[model samples]
Target: MSATAPTETQDLAPVRTESLAELLIATERPPRPSALSACLTFGWRAMLKIKHVPEQLFDVTAFPIMMVLMYTYLFGGALAGSPQEYIQYLLPGILVMSVVMITMYTGVSVNTDIEKGVFDRFRTLPIWRPSTMVGYLLGDALRYAIASVVILTVGLIMGFRPDGGLLGVVGGIAVLLVFSFAFSWIWTMFGLLLRTEKSVMGVSMMVIFPLTFLSDIFVKPETMPGWLQAFVNNNPITHVSSAVRALMDGTSPTTELMWTLGWVVLLVGVFGPVTMRLYNRK
Candidate 1:
């Protein structure tokens, strides 16, 4: 058999190929979400978390009631002479403390996500990162609102009345929500700095406890020693508490309101940039 010379295989034309990056850019990507959409998306996400883990709402739910009851009764007698009388002063101040206590949850939540690498995934997403953050913080609006309503309702049952009427209560809540929202950015920075969620919780409590108790939240700053009064007078939480008290009482809040708002602006301007920077570096 004549060994037929092996016919050289004809060279086939090179197949067209798309780089992975190009393929992803062309086909796999969806439109990036708008700022409002991103915010609403994360806001719903946070709400859903509460739904799934209903215990997550304890801070807004049973805790506030318990705190209102405990503080109003415990300190009311010693501080204001009667629980009924105490509720007037106590309500607004307790509202401030309740929200501040709950504000740490934002840091804890963000820290949990960071530990789970959820934030890493977020970085790769097309959504506005800041919107996600703002939305997450905004979601806390409902929590703050819930705590406000519950506290006020219980206060009513317990004989707490506001001379400022319904409008004043609403305005007080508005002020608290704005200040708390701005304050959450401070925790956001802590979330970025701390390694563990628990650490964030502990550190937040450490800062929050002294700040809330030592301020005018439960008692008059004048009752404190002159030395302590100096710090209490300057404490930003004191300004917020005074503002809330004045707002609820429908008094002129110019001085305290100015200071409270100044704190809000300062916290947001300073910690906001620092949180973003640390997040990006990570």
Candidate 2:
């Protein structure tokens, strides 16, 4: 009888199911990160993006300087009789405008990450759910602080003085940051809801321009028409700007600050859950 050739299966070793199980069990799974730890980690990741692309800082630095200079000179003589005098009024409001305007980029960043599928990996992770969103805000909070400092520096060079002194300036910036952090939730929600980065930007501009310009950023709300003033008086930007201005002027901004904090609560309350829902679904 002719010897039969050994089949491929006959040469193979028996499968080691027990060995595989033992190997997997050998290494203990790492514990899950706390919410704060996860958020801080993602926040650091955002900072790393800035480190890789230093140009990311242009909005906070160069744009703020330009705003301080342009508005100080352009409307200074006409509005306040001189650039120096106008900077006194314009700096605080402009700081608010610059920072708030830049908050849109948070949404842009979120959208870009989504488009590139970065968030898909994030979603697969076992960390806290809202950490990613909170991380974006925390990173952008640094941008907001930088913008505030840049604007303040430019204003100082241009003869803008804060009557509130160091304490006042610090308080003003602190309040601005709080409001900005809260305000950013709106954009985060938009970022999750919108399909494209450009769409997110367009909608943000539409909403921000009306809120920033129609309020007291550039001109006194009282100068506007009665109907417009009605809206401006109620605008959240108005409260924030007024609060900052009052703080810098070394006065108690109780009413404005209360209104601003209320808006902060209202904004986060309304948009925070909606954003999380979208993030989960997305």
lDDT of 1: 0.89
Candidate 1 per-residue lDDT, tens place, 113-175, comes to: 998989999888888768767877988888899988998899999998888889888888999
- The Cα error of candidate 1 at residue 40, in Å, is 2.2
Q: How high is each candidate's TM-score?
A: 0.89, 0.93
Best by lDDT: 2
What residue runs in model 1 are displaced by over 4 Å at the alpha carbon?
A: 1-31
CA shift of 277, model 2, Å: 0.6
Candidate 2 structure, TM-score to reference: 0.93
Give the Cα lDDT of each candidate.
0.89, 0.93
Q: Note each model's CA RMSD in angstroms.
A: 6.3, 4.6
Candidate 2 ranges with C-alpha deviation above 4 Å: 1-15
